[model samples]
Target: MNSRAIKILRELLASDQPITSDYLAHILDVTSRTVRDDIKALNHSLHMHGAKIKSTRGTGYELLINDDQNFRHYLNQSLNHVSQEQALLDSPDARIRYLVKRFLLAERYLKLDDLCDEMHISKSTIQSDLRSVKKMLEKHDIYLDKKPNYGLKAIGNEVKLRFAMSEYIFDRSETGSKTIWRDQLSTIADADKEQLDKVWSVIINQIKENHISLADIAINNLYIHIAIAYKRIKSGHQVSLINQEFDEITKQKEYRVAHHIVRAAEEIFMVKFPPEEIAYIAIHLLGTKMVSQTNMSEAELENIMEKQIQIMTTKILDALEAKMHLGIRHDKELLIGLGLHLKPAINRYKYGMNVRNPMLQDIKLNYPLAFEAGIIAGIVLEQEMDVSIDENEIGYIALHIGAAIERKKMQSSPMCCYIVCASGLGSAHLIKYKLKAVFGSRIEVMGTTEYYKLKQIPFDKTDFIVSSVPINEDLPVPVIDVNAILSDKDIAKIEAFVEEDIDHVFEYIQEDLLFLNKDLQTQDEVLAFLVDQISKTTKLPDDYLKRIYEREEIAPTAYGNLIAIPHPITAQTNDTFLTICTLKKPIDWADKRVQFVCLLNVEKDSKEDLQHMYEMLGKMVDNPSLIQQLVQCKNYRDFINTLLAQN
Candidate 1:
């Protein structure tokens, strides 16, 4: 199958339910007919194997496996074919990725001639690719050391080197090229693929036997850690865990599992692992444990959630509510869920163990509001725990927050309806009972009263007024006049009042604010350019740029995927407007490279629902292909067209 077909299959494998062809087509930037043809072709190829694509009439398609053994064989063969196609890495971006893995896993200086021969490229092309590679390496504090006759070597701190290796030596993208990195690793003489497989088998067995659940990406990270450790140990290097950290880790249940796995691997590989090495594996286990959210008594669960964790969770939700107003603070499930997630997460951060969140970009795109709220939670965590939390941890926290927001949406809160009557209490009672019976759980009758008593009643608690008599008093909520015996039209009107559609947020984007193909170098330069441009039209505060800088101090605005949404610490503009700046090239913005800069100035003393704006930007940040299109736009109209097409 082709790359697009493989991507479709990978997406299908990730999902449990049937995915519609239209959605797949939109994601793949292809037509529905093309997606259908690909599905037909893929199924034809899989028929002789185990799996087949089953399509329903109205529903989409799902992959059904008939023979597991045959499917595994087919998958192995396909992966090997993908490995053999490495010689086809001709594009600049493709070559960059290959060279990154190559340099990161290289043992000694690589000669220019050998590199050219390996990639089947010219000297000038290799030189250009090297410039891009140098930029990437510089971000990780790694420098390219070149000598007259010795060629080029990567020089950096060992820890930073391993971090950089972990990033590029793996297929972190949401595609079917997961094991392709392993194939690349086999080409490295120092990396023993067979030894790494032994570690992988040990980890899987321990995870299953101990009933500890881990996502596939987390397991893959564990495998990478083992391979790194093996390589470092063979090269006479070792990672030192603090004595206190080792003590703390040994007290956990994961430590026992790590011990067993380490012993088994040592016996098989005949390599002795120090206690610190075992503790290192235990750290990965502790950070990667998926919360087993199940039914349990409150008393039993309280034992797991310490008092401090509960307080931290409370502070996180409060900050989220104050900043985003997600209206999910009181969700008991959310409170307990965040508390449970933070407990292990706190330990992970205390020991400086960074967990790779494979779905970080996807989570930010799908749940922008929740992800922003997660950022606030990270800030709160930093304050309370005295340890900085990265975006990966924040993404995991967003999952819980997003689930809570969804639960709040699914829960139908009763609309409080108060009855106003001119007649005796009997008529009011009759109307109240009828409304309750009709609306059922949807409407809560807050008690019937006379029209004169309506003034004394608390309208703040009421959503709408059901008045049988003509009440001319202006109130905060909608007043629905209905007969003592409610009519169908009256019910429809009340329904309309109760149900409100979400406001469109992208309407706030002004065409004049868009600036394309600007020559920008640094983060401050981009921010200054945007501020200077918008300051002409809008009345911004004198300390506008300083306010934005302060906000960056609190947390960097770089949200990854070559996108940065920088806003002032507080609202300064007279009106809410989004100013777009697409750079000529990617510039360093703190730790991330950014080319698409969005300066959001919220209206002063204004309360507008801006969740849609965050979601829109999140979509742009998550899709690299979309960002590439956006950054290459030469005009405002082109930018708008590209953005609207995605929607």
Candidate 2:
């Protein structure tokens, strides 16, 4: 079957309910007729495989497997290999990774025509994929050197070349290609799986015996580099480092540990590691070695980490508090954690090492407020220490800040609540005394009042109203209806609300700011559309878009689930607002496909606690089915209702 037909089958298999042809066409960027024809052909193919396309009139298509055994056998024998082969070209993100690995491992320049022939894609398709390939390479300071006859070759510093190679090849989650990197590596050179395993064992033995501390990712990185070094050294390739750098790295304790690791590898591979090669391994060790000085007094923590790192930590927190008043400035745990993290980070920056953060996306989606605070902290860290930090490092810093935020929340004042009663003053006193007895200091009772005087009640200091009688009229604060004596269910409801304090989703979404199913096809187009729509009602800074782009540079705001939450690096408006846009089709935002774009901006010079709003957006970032529902929304009421239902 053709790739499009296979894609239709795949989509149908993934969805439990039937999907309309128009929706499939929109996803595939084809006409409804083409989707129908593909489904027809797909049904034909599935007939012999014990599966058929069950089409529902006025609904859509669903894949029904009549015989699971027969279908599984057919899939294993037929479609499995075809899908793997077709996925490279059928998916742009996958194709870009394929092209990157091809160039990274190529010994000589490659031709465009040859790549097209290999992938069975048109010249235009490969050319379009090349732009993304070039952008990905440029992130690691590598450039594609093009020739008239010879198509393209990646040119960059030798160290960066190997670093990019490790990331693209060894990083299975991000860069797993059609043929595994190990299989390709065996073809490209003398490097084999067995030899790499031996190198890994040697490195682990050395690190354990020498009393050195390194995270698992760090250890894997060192292993990959050393194995690559072995292959290059065997091929008569040597690394070049500045004399000053070579001298400084050789003096560290990590350099001695690297020596043992490299010496063991040299004996097994029957190759010798040059001084520069040993130093390269040492650089990896220096960059990734974690300092464990947690749960100590401030003086003890500061004493363990360098004085310079301690000073940098103080500045980072001070600056973070200055820009965003998160109330974590005096958090000693944060101070100690930042001090410990920044020390190794300094080594990473000095030697230009990039650490991979697997949790970066989850961190951004879950702790958005903390992640934004981490951005401010990153900027402060760069200026305070005169070093550059990437998103991966920023993610690590966010974890510490997130912990501090949690601590602040726990230690902050209790939820102030007001009581309303229709029975009498005695009933209000019984309710208040019961709440205090049950909840203790967790909730503070801000006096009680009768229901008739509720019109004159001020709610500025109250979090919510606990009323024994039902109040039909909407007030500024939420009212929780309860029995006069406050039943256990009522207490549980209040307990849950107090723990989360999540506001309704409607507070963040507005009818005027919501744009559904716009025809924008690119990241820039979507952002510009949202900015234009928002600017109609609210005045925005002249460089508002520029600030958003700057945040994107730090890390793409696309948090998967076809959602991208774009916001400025710093607050841009006088009030907090979110402008949302859902596209007709998914567009490429960095590496992920995004259909729902929420442009977020916090208020400037304001003291609003925005954790609840950020948490709401975070939940949206993590939910795919919810995003689908939001994307399918045709009107503001439906969209708002869908969000409220989910909320």
The most accurate candidate by lDDT is 2
**Per-residue alpha-carbon lDDT of model 2 for 196-219, expressed as tens digits?**
667767887888888789886677
What's each prediction's TM-score? Answer: 0.67, 0.80
lDDT of 1 by residue, 1-647 (tens): 66667767876775566777765764555678999999999999999999999999767788999999999778766644554245344235668777887788777898888989988889999999899899878766788889788788888866557767877776655444646666555444255677667777888999999999988888877777766766777776676766787789899999999899889877755678788888888888898786787355556668888888878888988877766667788888888788778777876776666677778766765676687678778889988888867777889899989998888767958889789988889888988887777778888988788987877778889888899899887888878898877788877667656653112455666778888888888898889989998988887888999989977865577766568888886677778778999877677775566778898887766656565566677677666557767877887678778876676
Error of 2 at 43 (Å): 16
> Each candidate: what lDDT?
0.77, 0.81
- Please give the lDDT score for candidate 2: 0.81
How many steric overlaps does candidate 1 have?
0
Check candidate 2 and list the clashing pairs. Answer: none
* Candidate 1: Cα lDDT at 611: 57
The reply for model 1, stretches above 4 Å from the true place, is 1-92, 120-143, 157-160, 172-198, 205-216, 241-256, 289-311, 382-388, 418-461, 465-473, 480-496, 502-533, 541-599, 603-647
